[model samples]
Target: MTNAAHIRLLTTLEHSLDSGQQVVSLTNDEDPLTLKDRVDRIERIELHFPHFTDGRAYSQAYLLRRRLGFKGDLRATGDVLIDQLIQMKRTGFSSAVLKDGVDPADAQRQFERFPAFYQSDVASETPVLRPGALEKPE
Candidate 1:
């Protein structure tokens, strides 16, 4: 919205639809597609996780991707951690803002730890078999 001459800010879901705003900021508990008829207007989604333990953001991301079919930027904000990066990507987060003082290289290694996975995620909505695949959980 920076490049646009006018930026429309809507506080609530109803206000957004009522005002015809394209951008939205959602709390973890709030569904991104509140106004189903105007879902296409959503250009970006920012999921706020108050704490690592508060993983409602993850569910919100999944709903946006699989249910709402949101193709816009799904960003993770607040209390993010290196360990949650892969899961974030799997669920549909396009990018994340990390905490200060965290090493980017070391954090990247966390994603490398798992060469493949069995669960169907946003990256691969259907599970696929890859070489050296981990045994399916019993």
Candidate 2:
């Protein structure tokens, strides 16, 4: 799970993005592979959720991280919820803008509840929660 500073909760999108930043807003249907050539030039990519039930952005984020190897910020926008933050981080979202009415502190608590996991994710190739898993046996 990401720290409070890592996963930002924005009450609104207005003025959230910095001017002159190399940002790309990709719809759920867009293919992240299309940006492979320009990944290095990009600084941030915003993936939209559209509706709370729509999860295509997750795949998009994964592709951006695992396939395209984008190291820049991966932000989640629109219809984001506190419950989705855990999976969002696992899939490679560096930040999220919480939807209206969601408490930022509550979102922080969610990360606190599950600080690590046993599954391999985009950020790490091996299970992180297991003791000594990161070290090779002699």
Could you say which candidate leads in TM-score? 2
Task: List all candidate RMSDs to the true structure.
Answer: 9.3, 3.6
Across 30-87, the per-residue lDDT of candidate 1 in tens digits comes to 8666846665668777788889999999988888888878877676777878788788
Q: What are the runs in model 2 whose C-alpha is more than 4 Å off?
A: 1-6, 13-17, 129-138
lDDT per residue as tens, model 2, 1-138? 236444655656432644446999999999999999999999889999999899999999999998888998888999998889889988999888887677778888887898677888875677865777578779
Q: TM-score for candidate 1, please give it.
A: 0.72
Off by over 4 Å in 1: 1-22, 130-138
lDDT of each: 0.68, 0.83
Cα error of candidate 1 at position 39, Å: 2.8
TM-score of each: 0.72, 0.84
